[model samples]
Target: MPRNVTTAVAGVVITVCAVAAGAGAAVPGKLGTRDGYEDAGGPVWYWPVWFPIFAVALAATGVFLATRPAVHRPAAAVAAVLAAQIAGRAVVGVRDWFNADGAGVVDMSQHELATVVTVAAGIALAGTVAACFAVALLWREPARGWAALRPRSLRLLVAGAVVAVGVPGVIALAGSDAIMLAGTVALTAALPWGGGLAAAAWLGPRARKVTVRTVLACAATTVLTFPVTMLYLMVSHGYDVTSLFS
Candidate 1:
């Protein structure tokens, strides 16, 4: 099979896995309880929201890879966005850790905490891998890519920043916790990826070529792994499948 075709196939597989994982994680537990399954500190709908977004991004990346000869720009942009999302998630995790109140601590056992920590570490590692891939991909032709992307990257970054901050702020002002939570989660997950892609778009436009195909494959794997892992954790902790719309 052609390399791009292979990449596209892989992307499809990853998207399917991500969607499955999200569906699995969305399974609800006993009434008024999550069966000790914490949402990484978010609302019940978090996984339902998270997985679909991830799948869409993965699918888009795959399509771009399959159709485009030199997908360096778009791929790098996607990588950047993923990196930013990872960073944002990390920040939120740390902030939540510090801000956790006494009741929160009481609710989570040592094992649960350990599980959360392990999942977080896994996510962090995946993010790091994705970021590295993005950097390497961009550096393959730093001067050329950078030159082509520099002006556009700046504009994209600025626009992404504004949307990232502004949309959530507006949602918060609306005063619905559910809407605010959903908006915050969506933006936090999406904006960073946008910004990162834009920022990295202009980098390494004239660097030496590396095993881009392999790098892209690995990156896709890493991206898909996260949701799978999360699904496993949720199921292991006794979460049951529930309707996403309900």
Candidate 2:
């Protein structure tokens, strides 16, 4: 099969599996309920908020792969990660179901099940972000307009710093807890793409084209904000990163 076709198929498969996993986790059942969930008490990061962001990312990845077939290698890597995450969850769920007690009751607690689901979701998120970085690197190419831009390193670094500082500032200024939470989720979802852009810019030729350079600069800024935002949440808001899966 052609590489482009393979990439598109893989993307579609990953997106479907990701959506299924998210939907399954969202269901209200013994596996989904928070009651007695091991990581339930960690933080306020809800599945409703996280799952949608995850699904969107997966969908976007699929679209990118299908539209930009040149990115097949990186896209395939990402799809593999997502598939592994789904497979891991399935394996755990099956094991729990089959290893029931003497009376045939499932031995896994609600918390344990929830934890497994959360962990799987977390893996997907992380894998997607990493894949974005890889794709950006693969897409890196020089543009003619980038030649006039002086001190590219300094400019990129400065742009990254601004993003790191600006996101939290904007959220704080929003002055509503709900808005802040929403902003954080949005930023988290966007971080990987931003980081990928940044990587491309940093790695691309100095005299690259104007549009490509601009995108790379923007991407760098966006990627840099994620860690800063997380830090702000941890120090100022007492947000626990580990609770993301919980």
Candidate 3:
């Protein structure tokens, strides 16, 4: 397949899977809720239908992980990290579900739940970074002539950052609390592609936009924001890094 074709296809697959996975997480929470509370006290993150989402997410993340890691190695690495993060979340959610009581309430307090999930996120982030690094160390050096930063490229990047930051900010400033939270969740899940969309807005030549560099840039910038988003969520919940455990 053409490199362009694979990159485009992979991006679309990741995007569709992202939306589907989110629905999987959310729909189950709504399945048997009472005023938004579920078996786990507050619609625990994982439920029976979560797999369908995970399966689709797995497919999206698998694209760059498969036979062409060398073609878009940065994207492959990002995909790996995304997969690990999702897996970690699923693990904690399922663990909590199994550990819940007869009343379907998890034994841990809300603070404890936050702390554990935060810890899990940290582990997932660190572990994936290490693994990607190891793989890069073993892989052959990439070919020379990486695209140079040009005037237009710099502008595109700046604009992209503005868009990436602006989307969530706009949602927060404009929406009600419930809407803001939902928008944030949906945006965060899009990750690198959200960044890519920023790039696409500027580089909209249907034939020429989806290059390796753009994809990697978008993936790198967007995924880096994940940590920031997590931090924001913690603060929004009125918990500090220390407070979660305190």
Candidate 4:
């Protein structure tokens, strides 16, 4: 893949990591509650909303990594685990919805639904942790196939992803009882810009070699525009960000 394409893929990794991390971050405190519907539910079951992006991003990352001059076995292993978690979560999210009714409408409590969602999300977290390990393993030796980053730069990369993903969430949650709502809403808001920035940051130097404009365009396309389009559905149509199967 081209440098721009690779950078774009990195943006997706940022998004997925944010989604997975954000979800994992939220679940610990609220995992076992019956009332963990809104904020908790959002993180527990937000996969339906983010899954397509996650899927596409994962595929892109795999392709990009494979084609890189060197391959980091540990990172590849971690990526594979992340892929499984996401894939499993996607499947289980659908399964929960299907269980709602054999062939008709079935009313279910948010609590009941949350149990299933949280369990699946837990599995997803395992996948993400595996990916983190991969990132770590590769970082120790970039030639092993890990994308190289200066120590200071790697910290900056992580910090950037967190802020870009978290700031909007804090704003959204300020007055709401629904932390889940806050997270989902904020994430919806954050994705485009956050993902874009992450893409640019990760690929910026690599892309510099390819052409700054092309790099920027790819970053913008994957990060900014795409998330905005996704967020628009929720804002304009009253889309529920937490509906597991929607």
How many clashes show up per model? 20, 5, 0, 4
Which ten-residue region of model 4 has the weakest summed lDDT? 207-216
Instruction: State the lDDT of candidate 3 residue by residue for 212-241, as single tens digits.
Output: 244454346446655765665454333468
Q: Global lDDT of each model? A: 0.44, 0.44, 0.43, 0.43
Number of the top-ranking candidate, with TM-score as the measure: 1
Select the stronger candidate by lDDT from 2 and 3.
2
Global local distance difference test of model 1: 0.44
Model 1 residue 77 distance off true place after TM-score fit, in angstroms:
2.0
Q: lDDT of candidate 3?
A: 0.43
Model 2 per-residue lDDT tens digits across residues 131-205: 443344344345656773443455544544445455555666766765644444334422332332333344435
Worst 10 residues of 1 by lDDT: 206-215
What digit string (tens of lDDT, one per residue) describes model 4 on residues 121-217? Answer: 5545544543454343233334525434533235435644765667755666567665645454333324433433343344334332222232233
Tens-place lDDT digits, model 1, residues 55-96:
455445534544562555456445435444554454454334
Give me the displacement of residue 168 in model 3, in angstroms.
1.3
Could you list the CA RMSD of all candidates, in the order they appear?
A: 10.4, 12.6, 12.7, 11.7
